[model samples]
Target chain A: MVTISCRDLDVDLGGRRVLSAIDLDFAAGALVGVIGPNGAGKSTLARAMLNLVPTAGGSVAIDGAELVGLAPSHVARRVAYLPQGQEIHWPLSVERLVGLGRLPHLAPFSRIGPVDQAAIESAMAQTGTLPLRERIATELSGGERARVMLARALATEAPALIVDEPLASLDPGHQIEVMALLAARARAGGLVLVILHDLAAAARYCDRLVLLHHGRVVGDGAAGDVLSDAALDAVYGISAWRGEAEGAPLFVPLRRRD
Target chain B: MSLLLPLLLMFALLSGLLSIAVGPAHIGLPAMVAAIEGKGDPIVRAILLDLRLPRAILGLVVGAMLGAGGAALQGYLRNPLAEPAILGISSTAALGAVIAIYFKLADTYSWLVPLFAVIGAVLALIPLLALSARGESALTLILAGVALSTLAGAGISLALNLAPNPFAAMEITSWLLGSLEDRSFKDVLIAAPCVAIGLALLLGQGRALDALSLGEDGARSLGTDLRRTRLQMLAGIAIGVGGAVAVSGAIGFVGLIVPHLVRPLTDRSPSAVLLPSAVAGALLLTTADIAVRLVPTAMPLKLGVLTALVGVPFFVRHLLRERRLW
Candidate 1:
């Protein structure tokens, strides 16, 4: 079982504390959505957990080992990350682009062998991007690019995947499909931590929700408990529709609260 | 993919042979063979061993360093317009060599010039490394490179303006034209080691550069030590390109144009682009050197001038036509 935990983590950027007293734990076989309003430091929190940002206090641990000072390759072997709003700089084919995910596993100067090829192919298949293998990645449409990026992350086959804002700029249909892919990944025993903006989608699909406001964790737990009417009204300054639809718990944000 | 390198290598080899064959000497193939056996005519022996061979080898080595250096710089900065000459790196090395000449240090010690050139290259690379680390835009990096190039040019111009004597000034001015004329085996010995180290360093970075196409953060996330990669690339470009400039003045635009000409053949993968660029660089330079020989002029065209003539136009076209590619 995989376990990622942050205990009272604090992060300072440019002499300003971006996150403070943030404590979070992620376990295997769960999709956890991190939700927050603007400037809530959600991205900062994710970066901290990945050891991308320096911690001012406390520690992050993956499987009981401190993440700070850990080799990036060691972290990559266990946790795959898909950063937000990525831009490809080359016109590499989709096949080669996703194949780069196997770098941490291969030795220097070595070619990708059959095992790596299999993993790359499977990742493309899983994300429905196999057909785009020959296409230049920089020329793809937005939805296709998102899927290709997801495929690249999946090719790592790491136990835990942390993605920031994967749904941004995607249309509704593509959004649901991507969400389903993440949900399936979690169900298949991967720990998936995603930063999401759609509260209803987070409520409907995630096993838990984390709410951050101004670098503080204001709410955490089941979506129903964390995204309550009072919680939404107090934190977001808005009233949201909360009910059940087709036996799945549903939530839709409405007008602002006074 | 496999055949591409061999093809370029063959082309470079032919260029080298052409460089050796087409000089102002009348050494036949039989005499060339006898010369290798040390029994040919003394004039033919001097022509082969002293004049043409070193020039051909220098052309090959300098060309490869430039080509590979350009491709590597482009990969590191993620900008197609990035090259040692256009970015002023070679000028810095040339400036270092000029300082050695201006101070007359080369008369005291022959090795001091390339050493100073390497030092000059590494010193100038500091601002570039810091700027790239800040993850600036392509345009910003290019602008900064242009500024550095301009500053280096001004420094060179100032040195030319204040020579100790007319002869000293002539020596300095001619060297800046970037020719491989009248070079000897000693010059080859001086340039080879630095180029070898730099080339090895450059070629080893293919995998890291491939990963870096994802950007610094993405490459870092994939377990690449961004700091180490940058340091290695910096050392490679400085030592190799700097050494090239030290021995043969400033041959501009070989690095700039070679990689662009080669990128389409390699699917634009930065890693795959480097070696072919090196080979193509050698081919282009050796060919240009040959052209320098054939051009009908009072004084034959300088290698630097021809490459700049071709490169500046191509660079402008690249800016206009392919802004979206990078």
Candidate 2:
């Protein structure tokens, strides 16, 4: 199985040490959730893995290959990404936007063939966006746009998918639906790594949890083992209750007493 | 859809022939056909082959290059408003051309203008791109481009105002307004190769441009080398836009408008937008050239005026629409 491993990674952004000696491993066929407070360097970790930002020290390796040594097209074909800041230039149709996922696989002068079309259609269908294929992505609602972006990542059909705050701005129903989709993707033997701020959703959906506090990995293990009350209180400086709701783990953040 | 290329090719040929036939000399279709087959009168053949054909071909090449260059820039920068005109290349080239003209450099060496224009365009890109690429937002890049363009414009105006001869000032003014007037086959020969190579470079990077559209972070994660992509794009813009602006004198909007027009044909994929934009640009400039020749005027109409007249409305509509959305 393929795995993304980072060893003693440090990241500096705008002259600030956003992350310090970050060490972690993300394995295949796992729904790995990264939970952290604001400014905790979760996004920085994701960027470092993608090689979008340079590491001040140490290195990241994917499937035994150093990230720095791999070509972009090679990495692109194996790893699909969904960025947090989504901005589409034109009112491209849903099908058209999703079809872009095949870009890495196609030659520069080539057109989309039957295989590409099939992939596009499958991605749209997987995200339940087939009915909206003709609609413009820019005109879609926030949740719909998020789904469209997810479909773009799915269209890559990569073994590994990384999404940053995919549930942000999504409604509760759509959030659950998207989380279920991620879980299913992981179950089907694809790696799915997501950055999330919602502790309850992270507790309920992800099989494994990686928590960051001030750029260091505070906890890493199965969700049940890593997401204890003490850990939450220490990381967030707040009290929280953990329990079960409808056969799934549920987390409730207590209101501040002060 | 597959038929688009052949269809556009056919139109390009037809429009080209129509351009030769409709000028003041009024060479009919039969005469034009004979000229093509090399059976017409020598003068008629010379006019068609030597005079009109090169001008038409030059327009086509320059337009296609600019269009392709603009598409590449917008895709690479991930900004819709990015184009040669707005990004300072054209204006810098214009300033270079003005310098060439005012110093009587064009009189001594006709090729000096295009060469300096090219160098000036590349020079402008070096600083502008460096400033923008170093942790600047897309908006900041556009703003920087505007500032540079204004500086170039002011420089051109200063050069014109300080010219020693009245003829030089008039030439500079007319050139600044932009034209393809009195252009000969030699001008066409000079620009064709640069434009062709630039277009090839841009088209070669189509897949890279697609990756860029997904945003810098997304593109990076997808294995796109951002620095290399930026370098390729800058080189292509310098060659294509520099050559076009050197020859055509800052024709606007072909780059900005062509992609929006052909996007649907390629299903809005940036990778797909390159060639269709090239063809669309060729058609547009050829048609505009034909219009200038057809308009009944004692003096020839400037091609830039027509493009701006058409482009301004579209730009306004786009801005209004963008406002509504944002």
Q: Which structure among the candidates has the greatest TM-score?
A: 1
Specify the CAPRI tier of model 2: medium
TM-score of each: 0.94, 0.93
lDDT for each residue of candidate 1 in A1-258, tens digit (9 for 90 to 100): 788999999999888999999988899999999998988999989888888777999999999999976898989879988888767889899999998898889898898999999999999998889899999999898878888888888898899999988887778887888888899999999999999989988998899899998899999999999998878987899998889988778998999976
Q: Which ten residues in a row have the lowest lDDT in candidate 2 chain A?
A: A249-258
Write out the backbone clash pairs for model 1.
none
Pairs that collide in candidate 2 are A72-B223
Give the TM-score (vs. native) of candidate 2.
Answer: 0.93
State the displacement of the C-alpha of residue A172, model 1, in Å, after optimal TM-score superposition: 2.1
Put down candidate 2 lDDT per residue, B80-155, tens digits, no spaces.
7677676787888888888888888989888888778877887887777777777535566677778889999899
True contacts kept of 2: 0.64
Which stretches of candidate 1 lie above 4 Å from their native place?
B86-88, B106-112, B125-151, B313-326
* DockQ, every prediction: 0.73, 0.58
Q: Report chain A TM-scores, every model.
A: 0.97, 0.96
